[model samples]
Target: MEKKEAFLQQLSKENQKAQYHVMNLMESFRAINSTLELDEVLKKIMHFALNIVETAEAGYIQMYDESLNKLIIKTYVGFNENISHFKVNIGESITGKVFEDGCFRLITTRKEIYDSMSDLSKENFDFIDKAHHNNQKIKSILSVPVSFGAKRIGVMTFHCFDIEDGLSETDLLLLQSFASQAAIALHNAQLYTEVHKSLDEVTHLSQRLKETNALLEKRTYIHNHLTELSVQKKGLKAIIIEMNKLMDRNLVYADYLEGNYVPQHIKHFAKSLDDIFFLFTSKTKPAYVSICDTVQIDCYIYPIRSGSVLLGCLAVEGSSPLSQLDKLIIEQGAPILSLEIMKLRSQTEIMYKKTYETYHHFLKIKNPQQAEITAKELGIHHHYFLQTALIELDGNVDLHSLENDALLLLKHLKEKITLENSLLFSYNNKITLFSSARDAVSEAYITKIIESSIKWWNERFSVVARAGISTGHYYPGQAEENHLKAEKALLHLKKQKKKGILHYRDIGISRLFLQHPPEEINSFLRETFSLLWTGQEKKDDLLHTLFTYVQNNRSMTSTAKELHIHANTLYHRIKKIEDILDMDFSHFEDYLKVQLAVYLYKTFFGSLTKAGKLM
Candidate 1:
């Protein structure tokens, strides 16, 4: 009778426990279905699933992140572990195993949880110990995958720290029941989230399309406006003015051809024009630069480049930022402006080419009257003095750019020094400049003027040239004669291993020496030193001493160094030559003879070799 009574009592207690769990399960279903909010649904699912095991202290739900391809902890309750950012790969941890196979797992022993942690660098079993409720040991965890049909969503887990035996199979079954309902709520909430995102994106794209169409219309208007300006044949300044009007700002068209501002002749108030000019010369990229410290305005500098040539720039001044349309206008107008610049350069080059051909024809004329008449036809005054130059370009100068260099140089010389009618041209790597002066200008004066202009050119441009200037002649007919003299002078200068401006008349008496026969040169040398050679010294040594003395301008120290002799010896030799020749050293006539004799000796017989050792 006693055994039966004990069995009946135990059965009643078990029935009451079943009724309590059933009541909680029904409440959980109602709560999970109440909201489509994924967070609230996850929270309610975790809350009711933990209720199925009263000993389970804390738990967390981990959602599978498709982007990260990992199970990331999304929500947690009843735990001090801020493991919201915790992540696990599929088939990695207990929760990962549940997510992979869509099954329920119960982790009871601490070693079971620690054994699942994988890493060569560390034993991550401490991580679970620290991450659990109150940083206490995890006695057990019941993990079950929450899935919507065949697609697994997340891992639903319940933690039990106080119970040593932890959760059983019955506990796993209750968690599965909770996850089944939770998956439906999560699926509905995910669809709701995705729909809202798609709506926002659509709105954003619509607004962007509207803005893009407006920008396109602005660009079209700019294109037509620039084309009309081009067709109207208005100058490049017209484009600048139109842009300034369109943008409502002060802008300048940096006319590279004219090399200055050409925007309707309006004087710029901003002082950074020079600064903008510096930037344009150095950099080719379009940019905004704070051009001036005093003005505190950012200048918009747009470089116009054709290949590697920086033609110029469109510089706009103001502190305000330019609109997209303003930038587009500059971008569209830069190419048109570049074409205009190229057109202007082409026209100028054509004009120069015609002038070059005509000048070439003028140079070829032999008749004095015909050449003078030709000079007049080419705009040179018939009565004006003619200054001619024959320049040999240096080897380093690029041959392709010689014509361009000549164009600039001749233009400068003509404007600065020549009368209204001057003809100049470059051909065959030699620059010939023949310009008529208004009056009879001295060749020395003409040379000075050319030197000044060349100095200016050298400072600003890459020009390596050696030029020789002929004596100015009043007749334009003497052009051919003067060209020969300039060429002779240039040849003499080049033979001297030198570079610079040389005057034809300054080539000295070497011309006289070269024209004379060797017999006459030797005769003059013997006549000049005959009386001194009658003495004890050898003729060549005496000649060497006298030549070195005269070559050093009679300086005893310099003469000794040139002859490699003592100063006292050179002085005694010079005195002996002066005494023996009966020649007065003070007379210009005697000094003249000695200077000419040195020239004659060098020209006919070359330098006389030393026949005796130095004293």
Candidate 2:
């Protein structure tokens, strides 16, 4: 009876211990499910698991990381913070094996856990072993898979310091039950986290959609504004003012063709506007926008162009970068601006043609009544002293280019002389300009004007040209006489072998040659140089030497210098001339006759032969 009682007492002690564990398990279930916090729930689960397995001193809950494909320690107790970040791959370590196999592992001895670790895990294990606090060491391990329904979520591991107190089968079973509850709580917490994240993402996307709609509306407004600006039928100033107001900036505009400024009420931005002009005229791009530096705030420049020709530019001063909409508006406005420039150009050209026709009529008419009518239409004062000039370009240039250059020169003349009563036209490869000054204007003043025009032509065309000015002051009806005199003066100036301005009065005795018939002049030249004209080659050399000799006042040395030949060569030529003519050098009569013949040949018949000797 005593043996049976002792056995019954021992069974009672075992039953009481089992009942205490059941109560602890119930308390753990309540504590772990108290909150939906995954981290807190996991911590409670680990604490309860270690409590139920009384001898275990350290533990950790490792959840499966789908992204890393590894088991990462989420909650831990009795381990250093660095160890809490430990990670294990599937089938790699004790916790990884339980997660991968979805089963419980009760390692009763240190050797069992160490033998199951891979070479990689052994290294990690050594690191974790050294990190144990208070000189404690891991002797046993019990790892159980934490699952929700059929899916395993993670592994809960418990570690002991003494082999004698290592985990038993009962401990593994109790921990597995705790893991089931932990898994459900962890899965619920995960779902809650993902739902909250999705809601935040939706909120962010909605805000972005609102912002994009507002931006689209703004873009539409700018497009409509630009379209309206493009359709307005008005002058360039009105258009540019509207553009300036739309852009909300200080705008300065120029029309290169008209030489007019927009906003006629504002002060001229002369210095600042130069940059815009230079860029527009120099650059070849059809449209361009660039940052420009100026006296005020820096600005953006948009060149106004049609095709390849630049009409002008619109300069806007502001403190912001030009947006795409701003650039588009400027580009669209360019055509409108170009149209205005072309219209102004056409009107000016028409006015110039009318004036040119009136002047032509004035030059052709003889009677005062007709001349007065044409002059009045041409806007020329009948009593003003009018002078005619003819400019002849000396080159083998293209006819079209020549005419264009001539027109440019005429424009420059009007600008330089600041004269409004000037008429210019191209006829017979010559640019003819008729300019009028007041009766009080001096001949010297008129000569200065002609000189300035010639100088301007030289600087612009980089070519040799000559201008002939009429000397006789005439009324409107006498334009024909003045124009004839200017032409005669130009012909005489060519024989002098000099370029630049020449006046009719300077021709002097050449006017007498002009009075005689061409046949009479030819006969005079032939009789004067009869002997030298016998042979073509010898005649050319002798006549040229004689002309140079006479031009230098019959001095042999000066003649040689002028001809760029040696004095001996000049002397030989002179001797040849004397022999050919059979005339004595000592006779003044013979020298006078030859010099007069040379002068007559040069004045009238120089253009007919190469050497200016009548054939």
Candidate 3:
């Protein structure tokens, strides 16, 4: 009867325990469902798991962190020490193994736990050591897979300090049910977190897009405004000023000039900012440069170019660095500036050509009515005394290169002379500048201009130029005569192998001799040098040596030096010439006659030969 009473008491205790477990599970469901927050739900799940499993002294919930590719302890309860810092790989420790196998792990003794962990790597062993140091000794353990559907999320582990019959079968089953509910709750919480994060990202992206659209609108407005400014054809200065106003900044522009027109404002600015323009023009493209030391301003320099031709440079100066929009404006403005520059250059060239034509007509036309009309069109008075300068290049320079050099020289001369009465033009491969003088221009002053021009040309193009100046002032109608006089003087100077400048008055008797008829002059040359004028191989040598010897005042040594020949060769040639002519060289009359014939031959016959009329 006592055994039957004891059995009834044991059955009543079991019933009471079952009822408590049912109540605890119901409470756990309500607690886990209370919030969708992942951390809170995980913590509640871990709390309920530790409470329902009475043998467990501590418990932890680990979640798979996709980014870390590891199972990290998300929440834990019941331990006197913290093991929240622990992490597990997918298939590494007991928890990892349970997660990997998607099943439950039961270790009934300390030896079983040690055996299970013995094969683990040093990192896992360190984790166990840390737990041991925390006084959370693990004598028994039960790790169950926390999964949703077929996807294993992580592992839920419970630890005990004392070894006992591992969890009972009913307890294991209840823990698995708890794990399923935890898994569902944690999965829902994770979905809610991801959706919320996605919504926040979408909101942030929308704000950025709006800002981008507004910026684009601003750029478009600026671009359209610049386009409108470009179409007005208000000139470069006006366009640049408008651009500066639009940017609300001061911009200093300077051009390299290069025989092109430069506005007066640009010239003044260039003078003020000479050092900056020099440094900026040296660059081959658009760039940002620091001119703080030179001009005390930060500026951006953009080269105004037209396909390898650097038209000029546009410099924008300010106290602050240029923004990307400012840079874009300059970039867009460069081509427009280039087009305007090219247009202005074309107009200037056209005006120059028209002026040249008028001057040419005034010199060539003999009709008084036509001459007066052209002179008026040329903006020149008939009474102005004009002096002409004829510039000729001496080399095998091409026509195009010569024209370019002449244009540059003319520009420099105009700048230096700065006379309103001067007109410069390129005509027949020569640069001619006609200067008006109330009285005769001093020979010294004209000489100075010629010498300075020669030096300038040599420094620029590494070439020599000879200029012929008419000696005296003349009426505008006598321009042709003065032009002819200058041409004769130039021809005389060239025959004399003179350089720099030559005046009509300096040619002496050659001026009168050059005016003689070409036929009479050729006849005189042939008659005087009958023997030497023959087209023989040695005739040229004999005549050349004779001329050189006479030119050196009959000094054989000086003649040899000038001709770059030995004195003995010159002596032999002189003797041979005397023999050929059958004349006495020591006679003064004979030598004087030969010298006069040599001068005439070069002055007249040489001119005809150059014109391809005489052999």
- TM-score per prediction, in order, is 0.67, 0.46, 0.49
What clash pairs does model 1 have? 379-421, 380-421
Off by over 4 Å in 3: 1-20, 43-62, 65-89, 108-140, 158-172, 201-209, 237-615
User: What ranges in model 2 sit over 4 Å off?
Assistant: 1-232, 264-282, 286-310, 316-321, 390-447, 453-468, 484-551, 560-570, 576-615
All-Cα superposition RMSD per candidate: 10.3, 14.5, 13.1
After superposing candidate 1, which stretches have Cα over 4 Å from the reference?
1-58, 76-85, 118-135, 161-163, 166-170, 264-283, 292-297, 318-321, 382-385, 389-433, 438-471, 480-615
Clashes of 1: 2
lDDT for each residue of candidate 1 in 1-615, tens digit (9 for 90 to 100): 999999999999989988877888889888888987777877787788778877788888899899999888778887555465467778876777888888787778877755654431132345455576557777777788889999999988877777666788777777677778888888988887788789999999999999999989988888799879988988777877787777756667764434467564324434555456545655778887775464465667788866555566777775567878788888888888888777776776677678768876777897888987887788777654667777665545455445445544665666666444555655645667666666654545667877787666555554456788876656655677777777777776565545667777887866444345567767777788776545444755776677777777878888788778888888788777787777766799998888877766564445644652221
What's the lDDT for residue 591 in model 1? 86
What lDDT is obtained when candidate 2 is compared to the true structure? 0.71
Task: Supply candidate 3's per-residue lDDT for 408.
Answer: 52
lDDT of each: 0.71, 0.71, 0.71
